[model samples]
Target: MTKSAEIETIAADWLRRREEPEWSSADQVALDQWLKLSTAHQAAYWRLEHGWRIADRIGALGPEISRPFSLAASLQTRWKRSRTAAVAAVVFALVAGSALWFHQRSDDVVATASFVTPVGGRGSIPLADGSRIELNTDTRLHTSVSKSERKVWLDQGEAYFDVAHRADEPFVVYAGTQTITVLGTKFSVRRDGDMVQVAVLEGRVRIDKDEGIERPRPAIVSRGDIALSRGEATLVTAHALGRVEDGLAWRDGRLVFDRMTIADAAAEFNRYSRIHIVIVDPVVADIRIGGSFQASNVDAFVRLLEDAYGLDVRREDSSIIISAG
Candidate 1:
């Protein structure tokens, strides 16, 4: 078996052992030590354990959501379906609510929703499990929250997630090539067409790409990692804690830029406002700019461009056209 597979096997074994009546606190300590040995161990355990929770919570939220399934007097519940995801196998157990073992290919889901934030506006969604999603401007998002799994699709734009940890249930976000598995992490995902960016602020998240999707530059991201995914390419890099905070300045109504190109800044601002900062000249577009600006104050940004940077700025309708003075 491959290294990853071996780790998963060990994780499954640990999960099974913990259900034993004889399992003690020392065993739990040992399991914790093993998980800390590698990020792979954590990911493996999270996925496998996520599977075991499915039988208890197959349906979506409603009055029946709290109701649990009774497998049988003797046998355990089996998986509902299989998916073509890259997973080799996911172990599940319920021998007697904590005993039998089997493998499942995917999550059992019932609830689904789709929502969006208007251009230049923000919105928040609270799930039944106490997890919350904050959407950025012009964002389209779809969600499925089954009893055992929470999945989100960022069809376009950006969103911030403050997840409540349910170790048994996995919280996953899909954006471009990113198949992000969250263990109660606070992070933001942004999708601009074919490119996707994930900036993590708290806790760690696993980013795995789908097999049939575009090939990615594989990366093992840790806490505070910035993961960017595009067609046939992905880049993962770590940042200081503060840089991660700055990346989330939008939550506080601020835009922080450090030596960002004029064109790039314009695109970032365009996401938060209807006013367009149009720069057609290569010279003006290539000039690097920096500083913190209010996300909604495009007029202040325009005045800065014209007065401070000595650039010619003309307003025509909704477009603020910039050129070299």
Candidate 2:
């Protein structure tokens, strides 16, 4: 995490702690010492505290937002009276940036690009800097590349990044609450809210938790490393390099399942198509299957499930419900 982000996080934590029921004298002493360490620390904490106070009135702003949206009008109307202009900007970022992104913010960005893939859709972005990013099904990514710094944000879904080697201009990717720094390497980041998985196919990448923004620990899989993270713990075992290649089969529009559970397979297939798959029977879900199938071909997969395994298959609108008869 950047120094600015770290300070913001620490300030938030201090604010939260002081408000707790068991907050002690020692905690206040520590906080005082921390604030005394730097003026930047004091500035961030105070601004965040003021914003925290303003946040309570956020719900009241709803009635006013019903008007046809005007970016200037909204920011002016809401923050015109606020003492700290910085907190207003922060509030607009965290609380209202989505609306801004969709409406006006995209045009304001310099040397930046935003891309998205619809449901069952796929896309690719080739940056001016020779770095390439492939967006998986239903993914959203934003990038800003300049001579001095290279940064990208994975707002949603999964993506494969083939970063061009530039030691001076490090490639930084932010996904969920994790920050990945790579000088040059091939890696893929998959995000589902707070859970993120980073798999490196070549070179190395440093993964750090951006505690100010989020707190989920990500599982890292280096070349020849197999990892399965559960809760706060992760299990990593060495595996053949070829096995890692199998996971990237999605890039070729194929879903490769190696003894994967029926439920898990269903979830994987669902990512590529709008047609949902629901495994109704727990017994049937536990059954494992393996294959390399076209991601968009759900019918073929269900046929195998029914004819090969003799499992019950029935359709319910958009869902393909499976059960053990």
Candidate 3:
């Protein structure tokens, strides 16, 4: 076999070894040593690892398909025959299964692109520089990249950003009148009409007023910090990173509430479904709730409310009414 093919075979073998139930420290050390030998070795291993992750996501089909021709088994068999062909086949399968993912990545690379997600839709986008943006429900955004900087305008709604680190060309996000600047960070920006919220999950970000006659002093927000802005005034507050992450559970198709009011919770649920949750009684609206729920499973949430809190639930054609029992 050619030298490149030999390398791929070795990488594929390493990947298979990782799946073994008895993987140990010695194996990890050996793999690390092999990866240190050359950049090509690292690249090949990463490619195989990425494909393996994709396969794992596909999981099992039926009994027949699962037993005889599972993705893992097919990959191993193909590797023995031809490593190049195996990689190509796995990549093709992943591309076919995740067309939307590839399309979003392509959109980010295109110069000056616009993206919109419907009321109940969520999506992830990858930028040309390897950064990723996760759009929440009912989001609208525009992106433009230049030699000097990367820019995004959050027209409305929310998005979580995993920025690519580039010291020379900083990444900036514009939400309403606030502008968030970062070098390399994981952050989220949410715009609710006149109010804008910025939360940093990792690294640091700077919040400033957009260019104008008199710009307010910029606020330096670091990890676990949240910035809230309305008009020209901005407030920066420190928060637990875990709590911040919980607030961003929408990225994983969940909504997490911590002692939040029923009225506020219903407003959040409304963002992810066509059937609106309405509180018929003022006392019911003030009821506090805390839990993690699937974003799109409004029925499950309503059932929880009815069963746990003994609330009366009335389902309408386009709305769900909740009242005191």
Q: Could you give candidate 2's per-residue lDDT for residues 237-314 as a string of tens digits?
A: 555456567778888888888899999999999988889999999999999899899988999999999998899999
lDDT for 251 (candidate 3): 87
Best model number under lDDT: 3
Better lDDT candidate (1, 2)? 1
Q: How accurate is candidate 3 locally (lDDT)?
A: 0.73
Model 3: per-residue Cα lDDT over 161-259, one tens digit each: 998888677888999888899999999999999799988899999888888826647888889988889988888888667778888999888999999
User: Which regions in candidate 3 have their CA more than 4 angstroms from the true location?
Assistant: 1-110
Candidates 2 and 3 compared by TM-score, better number? 3
TM-scores of the candidates are 0.65, 0.62, 0.67
lDDT of each: 0.68, 0.67, 0.73
lDDT of 1 by residue, 216-282 (tens): 3455556688888776567878765676777788877789988899999999999888889999799
Error of 3 at 43 (Å): 33
lDDT of 1: 0.68
Q: Model 3, 191: alpha-carbon shift in Å?
A: 0.8
